[model samples]
Target: MKTKRRAAYFFTSLKLFLREYRLFVLLGCLCLLGGVVVGVLSARSFGEDYYKLNFIFELHSGSYSFAKTFFLALLFGWGGLALILLCGFNRWLIFPAFFLVAFLGYRLGLGFVGCLQPSGAGGVACVIFFYLPLYLTAGTVFIVYICMVFSSICGACGVFSSASSVKRLFFKALPLSLVFAAAAFFSCILIPLLYKLFFM
Candidate 1:
């Protein structure tokens, strides 16, 4: 009975959050779409030749270590920040959270373009098979963060009990963010192996 009651309460809170921030969610979706559009337009400049040339050089020259480290650091760092944002609420958190979402969306979009290319098909396959899940998890976490930010903003302006309730509501998202972050961290190890298999 206690477990059931807790589950019910969680669902109720989720529903209230969705209902309250529906517009902001829509805005986030639109921004993601815009990011994708920009990515597609920019894809023409990121030709297969450039990708193959650089990727081949990196494989032969051992410069890929820098890249692998950078990618892991970036993804893990973003995940960490998202997790932190999930447990707190501040009106000031909105811009950075949204920017992270937009940037990730744009990169994912570019990656999709790369996936569609014949030369990049194998790498894209790896991304689809492996990185896609991680990216989706990260995206979900960011969305939740944005929701928290919006909620905090409203709360700060008198919609609720100020920072206390905002903090309470935001912390409710912590479990999901932690789950996502773990998956992303584990997935990071696959990066070099996948690159070797696909590009090397």
Candidate 2:
């Protein structure tokens, strides 16, 4: 596709995904609800043997703790898109990106939940503020990949994965890769800004 057409397709793709406001609003509602609940739950509270963060809490309510979990899930959902695109780009790196993004999300989620504790505010208060927003931003980056990946794979035969098609997928993913990097950058700026916006 010509550059203009391609960019237009890309923007259209964004509009289509944004139309599903429920998923985003669902998360937003969860975050708001968390602060209103009366108890908290930690990773260990669930007894999972997987990687765990030791911080615990008894918050204004448990509603916020559950909201943090939703935030984390949304975060990993970003990594999941990154993984799918990694597969599209250099099939070889797919698995690594998948695990790394997932690990980041899980560990970060744990840390964030810690901050939501009734008294857990301080320097990283900013970090906690942007968790959900970052998830939404990164998710858009992922959605673009989904669009490109689907276009590349939809009409192909069962077994003959074409190198040209892979290349196209990679190129399509280039902007999103930049987007992910930029998302991280903007996230750094956004967190502090969000902290001021919400807490200052």
Candidate 3:
């Protein structure tokens, strides 16, 4: 009964948070999409030169390593969560959070282009099978963290205009962030295993 009550409260808090900060969430999504489009266009325009210019492309073009993929995904997930959590203390940190999301999206764009170059339809399938889950999980975590940070900043700035309100917002965001973090970490860990099973 206590567990059920806690679950109900969690859902209620989440619903209120979404309603209050939907615009910030939308902005986070747009930033990611915008970054992806830019990356795609840059790769298309620059071709081989772009591959040379971007170290991430070099990393992607190399042989696949389960250890490397696992580590990087772990870093992307938990590291991003850490960064977003820190952003709550200073508004300036928000810029880094935004950049991190956009940068991840850009990396995804470059990777998608690379996948298409050799395999065509098979490449698309590879992305759907392998990359999509990892990136989507990371992206969800990032968007939520970004929103939480933004909301915290607003609360600090008196946008919420009440100490109790600010505290309530923090409490709501804290558990949600932790939940997403765990999900991101597990999803990332699963990706390398999935790749090894199917692609390797």
In terms of lDDT, the best-performing candidate is: 3
Model 3 TM-score relative to the real fold: 0.67
Instruction: Encode model 3's per-residue lDDT on 1-200: one tens digit a residue.
Output: 99999999999998997898798777778878888898788888887533322222333555445456556766667777766766666666677878888887887787677766655565665466555666666777778867765665654543245566556655755665566555544444454455446654
Clashing pairs in 3: none
lDDT tens digits by residue: candidate 1, 60-138: 5666554464467455646645444543445555656666667767766676665555346555654665447666666
Candidate numbers sorted by TM-score from highest down: 3, 1, 2
Best by TM-score: 3
Clashing pairs in 1: none
| Candidate 3 CA-lDDT value | 0.65
Q: TM-score of each candidate?
A: 0.61, 0.45, 0.67
Could you tell me which 10 consecutive residues in candidate 1 have the lowest summed lDDT? Answer: 48-57
Q: What does candidate 1 score on TM? A: 0.61
Count of backbone collisions within predicted model 1? 0
Off by over 4 Å in 2: 1-82, 86-111, 118-129, 154-160, 189-200
lDDT of 2 at 43: 49
Steric clashes per prediction: 0, 6, 0
